[model samples]
Target: MDIKLWQAIIYIVLALIIGAAAGFFIARAWFKNYLKKNPPVNERMIREMMRQMGRTPSEKQVRQVMSSMNQVK
Candidate 1:
């Protein structure tokens, strides 16, 4: 390959690597911020939701629901 071609190829590869790394970090940060703003379903929310549905949730049921939700994640 010509010297200039090799240099161009090297620059492109470096840019791709840097872009990929930057994209990964940006996406990771966005996801964390989204989670902080929206949050996830928790045991207290589940219990409240169940209560609103006119069913009293037991401790064991709440724990089971929380475990199931965690497993999906």
Candidate 2:
């Protein structure tokens, strides 16, 4: 019946959406945990460098330092 077919389609769509959302959340959590385990050393170095530079470090600067640090081997 047409009604049954539509119901099946709706269920499939809902399942796909739920699966995608769950995948995104899992990936985000895993990445956050990985970063916590591997602390950003470059950012720490940059902060020390900034202190030596006698300049007030901003949040943006700290992020930049972390980004650059992530690029290192």
Candidate 3:
């Protein structure tokens, strides 16, 4: 193979690597932001969890749990 062909191959490989890394980070950041804005667990889910644990959650209890969870974010 010619020297030019080798150089072209190296450049293409480098570009692919850089693109993959950048895309990975961007996708990860977007997912994190999406989850933050739309939390996976809501009031109903929390109530269900408490019920599973054998306790019926009250409005105050649910609100407290929500506040604590949001504070962590």
Candidate 4:
């Protein structure tokens, strides 16, 4: 069976839209899973980092660093 020009264009557009939607959801789910496995920074991580840097971090210093990070975001 032969398709008309407009019908072919409609089918192509529909395919593109469907593909884009599927790609978006797949990427989003993968990103969420990746973040779940490798989560963002937290207070404990900050403290450990400071310790590794050879600095004994005080509570106030950690909180200050956290606040600064929050402000940047």
User: What is the C-alpha local distance difference test score of candidate 3?
Assistant: 0.96
Candidates' C-alpha lDDT: 0.96, 0.87, 0.96, 0.96
Q: Write the per-residue lDDT of candidate 2 for residues 9-59, one digit (tens) a residue.
A: 999999999999999999999999999998656666777889999987988
10 residues in a row with least lDDT, candidate 2: 39-48
Total clashing pairs in model 2: 0
Ordered list by TM-score, greatest first? 1, 4, 3, 2
- The positional error of residue 29 in candidate 3, measured at the CA in angstroms, is 0.6
Off by over 4 Å in 1: none
RMSD to truth, every model: 1.6, 7.7, 5.4, 2.2
Model 1 scores a C-alpha lDDT of 0.96
For model 1, give the RMSD to the true fold: 1.6
Tens digits of per-residue lDDT for model 3, 1-73: 6999999999999999999999999999999999999978899999999999999999999999999999999
| Candidate 1 lDDT, 1-73, residue by residue in tens | 6999999999999999999999999999999999999988888899999999999999999999999888988
Worst 10 residues of 1 by lDDT: 64-73
